[model samples]
Target: MTHSERTSAQSTVDIAALPSVPKVLLHDHLDGGLRPATVLELAGECGYTALPAGTADGLATWFREAADSGSLERYLETFEHTVAVMQTPAGLERVARECAVDLADDGVVYAEVRFAPEQHLDRGLTLDEVVEHVLAGLRSGESQAQASGRRIRVGLLLTAMRHAARSREIAELAVRFRDRGVVGFDIAGAEAGNPPSRHLDAFEYMRDANAHFTIHAGEAFGLPSIHEAIAFCGTDRLGHGVRITDDIDLGPGGEARLGRLANYVRDKRIPLELCPSSNVQTGAVDALENHPFDLLARLRFRVTVNTDNRLMSDTSMSREMARLVETFGYGWPDLERFTINAMKSAFLPFDQRLAIIDDVIKPGYAVVMG
Candidate 1:
């Protein structure tokens, strides 16, 4: 299709006409997406200072506004309040369980939630304890979701703060819990100053142990960081890889032209965890209308949509998908493509991933198509 024709097709798509479709999320942050009510309750129990908002609705709105402040640092500041309440085992378990139930309600069949354990140590909880608590919570939530007739499976990605030197320790922790619930390892923090190279020892340890991991690269930083994450660090997926758009050039008539990096990502079909609203909040991209999702999808990139932080961004997978459809005029087919991208990019073992795709994804999407 011509550029104009494709644009027109996107513009004419309807949102309400879409059916409830199965979704997969691979880049949600655990400490960043807790339910506001859970945060308040945990804060109260832990004697932590509460934010200005008390009720769930008010707290949720407060988080969204803070995350939308158009500065990555400001967007990150919202997590301070959430991490404050999530330092203990009970707090971690409750928040994780609630997240699972919430994601199930949003039609997410599988999700990978990540968080930096180092951040939670301020309350005196050991790293292993933190992981155990979160794991128990996820299992509890999974059971709750299944009991409610909503099937949902969750994997935890233990994140090492990039600015910290504990990535190697976190990597080992992730491998130790691979069977317990943790599926992968990640490095997350301010991306601009601390690049993936800073965590080389951890990446090397993960690589040697044959552990799967993805780095939070190319969100605040640019293509160079993304390239290092893939080439040097050997990431299985990319988190908030919105800046990949920086490498692509658009023609005067709006046709896309890919640079070497963009072409490599597309040809390899590397999974890009693109969070639309979160991208806007971080100033990673100017606007949702200008999000690289439509551009990347059209170019056949392995692009999946996500809510980086549900509470912080006040978003769910359904809401994020709906926003993309409304902004880019996506149809049911487009949504299906994104779901497939996420499933294909999941950190599950090959057999498990295939099972989810064949038994869950295809069948569910078929119903949506019908």
Candidate 2:
């Protein structure tokens, strides 16, 4: 087929078929992906009554509305109730398990879900215990997903809040569970006052241990944060690095000039976990149409789509992909390329990453395309 014909064929893909096309997610947050019914049940079990609504549907609406506040800090506030109920082993396990199952059902063949262990210590669980329970739940969830014939591999990325001082400790904890289901490390939270360089010790520890990590930068902040993450902390990937567009100059006649930072990011193939819906909800961009994902993708940057938070944004991997298609007219090839980008950038071992890309991702996309 000619190029135009191929493009026309690709554009004919039904958006409803998205859920069956395999995807890879690298920036999902565990605490932010809970099922509303599970949250209510867990809250009742844990005696945490601070939920803003009584029914599951009401609670879901509340979370979606609260997260739509257009401020990263306020968007984060919705986590208070989630973290409150997830204080016990059962809560953590159930949440982790459900997260795996939900992603699997959404056609995520491989994922690295992150959560801050320090925040789950409210009910006296130690850092180790928190990690252990979550790992166990993830393993169980993987088993359950397999039983349901939706195979998925979920890896844990232990996160430390950027505003907290326990990054070194959290880094150490991530390393401790590295051989288990845990795959990598990260720092996440509001990015206004807390720069990624503040957690240099943690990044250094990860580098020394030969482990992989991504930093939450360039979302709420700008190019400076992306520069620090790459030049200083040496992050393996960028979580929500949408703001890297600040360095690009779009000129007349379809010409684009890349400043040093943007050029370096493109040259290095640094994966940008661009969460379209969540970025808009957090005001990283005014709306999905204004997002720079298409520009970055066209520029050959290693851009990957992600669902940063499922419940808050009421999205899944398939939903995120569909939104991009609707807004940018992405074809099956574009979706396949994004999936390959995420699989390649995953913290999994090189051989394992390649295996999933070749065996699962490519074959699945081929079937969908055909």
Candidate 3:
């Protein structure tokens, strides 16, 4: 059979069948995935009286709508409430623990959930204390998932807000916790005016220390932002590097010719943490059909799927993969490739990463797809 015929003959998967597919999530937000009910409870616990919605369902709807506002800055305004509620240790631990539990419930076996250590400083928790609380909560969540016969291991990514001046400090915290649950460091926030190169000192410091780091780039901004992140800041991975789509040259019959930048990324296998639903919500693309995900994947650009903000996008790994499978006619082989890509690009040690790919993800998908 011809390649196209073979591809067309692959079975389509139902969305409900995706939850047991053994997903590996590389880019997700801790504050962005808080349960709506938990958000209400935390607001009450912390005396945050300015929530726009008092009811659980209403608040959830409010978050989804606000993130879909088509303005990047406005989309970010929703985080104020989540970060506000996460000031205290109890609040941090609760959210962190729940984040892990929810991902495990969605059949995510390995994940690296990130949040800004600088953003949770409203109530005066030291940076060290903040990291400790998140790590403790993740440990608690891991134990809970294991007890439920669902195996999950979570790692923390300490993020420094790019618009702020704490990247160096956050980098230090990440390196300090390298042997702990902390797996990597990152810088996230608006990408238009604040370039990742602004945190060069932090990136260079991580390089010197041999630490892993990913930079949030090309989500709202364009190719320049991505160029600086890769050429200047030297991130090991890109968080939402979807705008690299602008660099591809599609000539005749949809034959893609890689531009210099695209060639560099594809040649180096720089992992683009492509978060499709979030990209659409934030106006990164016009719609799901217009997304560069299929093109990037076709070109073998080391693309991996992610839910940038689960609550904000109202997405899970299952939902994200289902959307792609339905749109692209991706069957088990495609889903398995994305899962293995994420696992390979994970920030864990080489041995641990390989172990999961072999012992857990491979076996899990084999059973599900069989």
Best model number under lDDT: 2
Candidate 1 TM-score versus the reference: 0.94
Which digits, one per residue and each the tens of the lDDT, describe model 1 over residues 62-129? 88888888889899989889999988888989989999999998889999999988888887889999
lDDT of 3 by residue, 23-79 (tens): 999999999999999999999999999999999999999999999988889889999
Off by over 4 Å in 3: 1-10
Please give the lDDT score at residue 232 for candidate 3: 93
What's the ranking of the predictions by lDDT, best on top?
A: 2, 3, 1
lDDT of 3: 0.91
Which residue pairs in candidate 3 collide? none
Worst 10 residues of 3 by lDDT: 5-14
Better of 1 and 3 by TM-score: 3
State the TM-score for model 2.
0.98
- Give the RMSD in angstroms, all C-alphas superposed, for model 2: 1.1
Better of 1 and 3 by lDDT: 3
List clash counts for every candidate, in order. Answer: 0, 0, 0
Q: Model 3 residue 98 lDDT?
A: 93
